[model samples]
Target: MRLLTVLYDRGAAQLIRAWRRSLHFRVVSVTLVSSTLLVVTFSWLLASQITAAQVGSRLTEAQKQLEQGRSYLEPQFRDRGDAADPGLNGFLRYATALLVPADPTAYYVLLEPTNKDFLKAVKPQSPQIEDTRAAQDAVPADLRQTIEHSRKSAYQYVRADPDGRGERPFIVVGTTVNSAMGQYSLFYLYPLDEQVDSASSVRTTVFVAGLALVLLLALLSALITHLVVGPVRIAARTAQRLSAGLLDQRMEVRGEDDLAALATSFNQMAANLQRQINRLEEMSRLQRRFTSDVSHELRTPLTTVRMAADMLFANREDFDPLAARSAELLQAELDRFEDLLTDLLEISRYDAGFAVLDTEAVDLVPIVNRVVERLRPLADRANVELRTVVPDEPVIAEVDPRRIERVLRNLVGNAVEHGEARPVVVTLADGDGAAAVTVRDHGIGLNTGEDKLVFNRFWRADPSRARQTGGTGLGLSISLEDARLHGGWLEAWGAPQLGAQFRLTVPLRAGDRLLSSPLPLVPEDAEPRLGPIPPDEPSRGVRHAS
Candidate 1:
């Protein structure tokens, strides 16, 4: 029973989902439901109108027949003398025999005088009804009261035995026939069984026809939607393939209709996009090649320049003050230039997809400490304090130690370079099969939205402000690539003047995906309104080049 319940629930859920998602299903279902309601309303109105018309027609004919029988019968009552006359009962019986129709479903009733109580002693006041002994009981009291006083005829519907033993509905129309002898009420009991049967059959026919009409409307709606939705579905699929690098995907055009025109326009847009993408690809390829060639070509000259600069520095004490100063400046500039070349070569390798990871199980604490310790001199020169908040337990992970060290150096170096003489904190944490490192600096922090822009190659916050360490501006971009290569995340968070935090999270096992990081991207001491980034969504700060 429990399994059946679960199966029913699953099926219902799938049906509900399909109802919400499918345009064709929704359109057809709505049309069917609305059409059914309309058909029901119209069928009810039609059936009701038909029933009323039949009753009206029957009533008019019965009234006409009553008039025809009364025209000649009133004269006989005039010649029969006053209410005290003898043989009046016989006269009534004779009048009934003449007036009653040949139809078996019909009958007649005649009642005695309303006044002249003295005549009641001569004859009984009991009504005279034709054909049946108990037919007098069928005339309702309310109907008799109206007919007794009025000259014009009136009708009332009642269920009564007209022919005795069998009960059915009837329309009793009664009128007054006046003469010198007395007043008389003549009533005709008309059985409505035939009209009832006719109305019932009509309702049934209308209902069946309405049902058929609803089905036909639904079918037409489905067919129309199919013609429109079919091409739209095909266009959607073609667009998907085009986005997935199938540059030649195009829509098929048929006759010169609106749909064909739409297909032609779509094909033109796809072609234009393909051409633009091809042009961009070619330009990107040429740029990468140029960088690689330039970096390689400069190495030999850079080496020769390095050797000469080193020799000049060694012998600089014997030269004049100006000469010694120039030699020192040249050596410093040469070092900065070489670093720039190295960064460019690294970027070119990354762009060409030549960079690789060499992984092994190693403790990350040592790597963090090494990066911090190596950059301590730079921190001190910048008047910035360096701090580490690593756990006593070794955070072991499968990673390329060299690549991790490089990423750490880039993060820590940036912190110290811009720490504004404040403390730069490096916290290493591990949990949930992942290891994370956050480098935070209370410095001239990044401006709003600069957290993402900082990772772009050659991007600088204040480009005119001279860099003390002569940065090549490619560190963060390379770090982002390295993190992604390990199925990990490199993220950043910042608010203007508050501080900036850079988080690097990698899986403990090689090639494993990182679901979450051990440390938050937003620092604890930052602005209260700067909420921590959700671990599930890809942070905008990590959207650098692949």
Candidate 2:
């Protein structure tokens, strides 16, 4: 049943496509049908005319034979049988009878008017037609009228015989033979069933020939249309490829027609497009490499500066008041700058596609606990609660522990800074082949379009707000890159006043791709409340459930 349904669908689709594609098929079908109808009508008219002409010619010849017989027999009747010898008279009678048409059931009948008993002497077989009146009734009404008025004349057609042995169409001629005493009548009948058989054979041959001609015409029409439409189909296919970003799509030029010109123009356009794309790709590659190299070169000196600053900060008690304050500010600014540099370098590496995942089996519960503990001080300062929700069983995943910890640390710290004195939720869950972590905050949340921009480097919802949180503005971006490097996903969902949710899902195996998320990215407390996060609001900190 399934196979039959599929076949029916395919056939229906093909018929629709053919109707759309083949204008010539439609025209050929109409023309063939019309021509067939016209040919049949014309052939029938011609057959009727030809049959009438042949029947007329046969009747005229029969009439001439009858007149010749009369000329021979009239002299004998005029002489009252005085001139001809007995043998000659017998031979003349036999010759006259023999001259009557024979094949196809022809017959001659003569009625003597002088002797009423002459009909009795030569009476036809039982159920005898007494005269032409009875014979006229045997023909159709139309044929009977023609025969009744045709004295000494002939009429021909197809009709049933009076006795109904069979229907064999025939011709009939009648004439008046005047004798000494009264007027006698003579009639001749000639059948034409054999001529009808020949005509039928001719009609059959013509019908077969006409069918073959229609088939040949249809084939020729299909071939001609296919050749004309082939180039258009090719051009359409090539245009589709170009639309799909295959800029090198080109057509084969055959002749100097309109289609060939189109092909030539298309090829030139593709060549120009290909050259432009290559140049852009080369520039992009160089830019990413330059950024990567510059970051690497600056990091070595920055690390030395950071070490020297740390030494001075460690002994800041020996310095003067102004010098100590200066040292504190300088060290803090340096830390922020260092974070920015590190994020830029990581971004460069990702841009160059050189970031590789270093996977190892690690317990996710410990990693989450460590990040929360490290950020606990910051959360306390922000007056926000910190909590965690982790599974009792060890949730082991093949991930880069360093990157994972960094991502968690960034999410927790951001939530601490933005969570507006409300609770923060951190959830961990394991699945068949993957694990998920969700960080949610009842803080100032994102606007409708800010979910994607939240991960862009240096993107801030309110740039005018003070930098009290001390973030380098690239932390979220870096965290996103880190998750991606480990073949994981970091996605965010936020609404006005509804707080924000961020989910990080990673596969259990090193290179496995996650197909399902165990943790939901929308906070459970989001419904019924809607508002945008304010720029100047201070936030409650991260939460942990362990």
Candidate 3:
């Protein structure tokens, strides 16, 4: 039963797939089925009408012949006068010989009363019919009863199989004949072989014609479908070509029809899209040029300002306290400014497509550990606990160590800044062909819908809040670009007050596609709980562990 069910389901699926793939097949199949049904229904109606007409005509003819036989035999009986009583046997035999058709296509039977008590012990005689018993039995009992009970002429259709011959249709007509002798039942059987043959011929003709018509309709339907679907197929191909960067491809317009108009519109759309793309390309080229030129122009002045600020900050103890503090502030601001300019330069290099990776097989565990150790001082000041979960085995991958270190630094720093004095977990794991790192901060967390925006340049979860570390806001964006360079993935997930998790997944070898991340974006220990933090909560911090 299971195997049968599987076979049935497989068959059904194949049929459905076939039905969807070919419009021509669908159309042809439907047309053939509908035409066959119509042809069969019409043939059945025509055959029924023909059979009824043939039977009606044969019944009428049989009734007339029966009446004629009765008339001829009755007259003979009447002419015998008083001699009819004793001469009934002679009359019956004579009538039988006279009335039975010599053509062999018809037969007759004459039945007379067996008892002759009214003739003073004279035995009534009946004419012998060849195969009389078989013929009598062939007639339906209901039809015989109908004739026996009524003097009115009656007829019925029956199949006659004489002498073991195959059954053939026949019409049986019966009536009572009155004479000086007792009444007799006269029956004439007429063979309908000719009518049956004609009907068979009609059926064969109808079947052949219906089949031919169905075939013709199928051919016509296929031709029509081809004419309509040809243009659609061409349009689909041309569209595919356009999508594949063949901007100059266009459909040929042949006539002033809807299909031609559609082709015209499609070509126009392609032309318009090509123009817009060209314009956008020109604009992007100009923008990148302007950014590169501006960054280069500002570098000279920025270097001079940085030198002056450093000199003042170094000699600040010689000045008043307020002057010293101002000089320190100036140095810090200049440092932040320099960092922002450096980030902008890096972004410009990425936009100009000049960034290149110096890849090497490096263990990511030390890199992650070094980044966390470097940020331990900052984490302590922020009162945020930092935890590391690195596998003992080296997680080796082909990556640019500098870029990977920068990415990790940015992610860990961002988590510490937003940790809200809560614990932050940095995890690293290795898979079969990939390695991943996750930085999860159980901080004030992120608001709904801000997870993806966190990767955008300069995007902040809370713009009103100032950064303790003075982030340049290009960190995550540059990190994403760096991951993409290695054909890796950088993804973020967050919930309200449940902290945010940033995941970086890379292939074991540079340029290889990473199918999955070894580490989950969401921490396993995090639960869905909501409450307000108490003001008296102590600031907790943890030291880094390798």
Please count the clashing residue pairs in each candidate, in the order shown. 0, 15, 0
Q: What would the per-residue lDDT of candidate 3 be over residues 280-340, giving only the tens digit for each residue?
A: 9889988988877887888899899989988999999999999999999999888888888
Q: In model 3, which runs have C-alpha deviations exceeding 4 angstroms?
A: 1-18, 63-84, 96-104, 113-134, 145-157, 163-165, 173-186, 321-326, 352-354, 527-546
Q: What tens digits encode model 2's per-residue C-alpha lDDT throughout 397-482?
A: 98999889989988988887888877777889989688999898988788877887888778887787665568888888888888
Question: What is the Cα-based TM-score of model 2?
Answer: 0.61
Better of 1 and 3 by lDDT: 1
> TM-scores of all models?
0.87, 0.61, 0.82
lDDT of each structure?
0.83, 0.71, 0.79
Cα error, candidate 2, residue 397 (Å): 1.6
Judge candidate 2 against the unseen true structure and give its global Cα lDDT, from 0 to 1: 0.71
| TM-score winner, 2 or 3 | 3
Comparing candidate 1 with candidate 3, which one achieves the higher TM-score? Answer: 1
Q: Once model 2 is optimally superposed onto the true structure by TM-score, how far is the C-alpha of residue 391 displaced, in angstroms?
A: 1.1
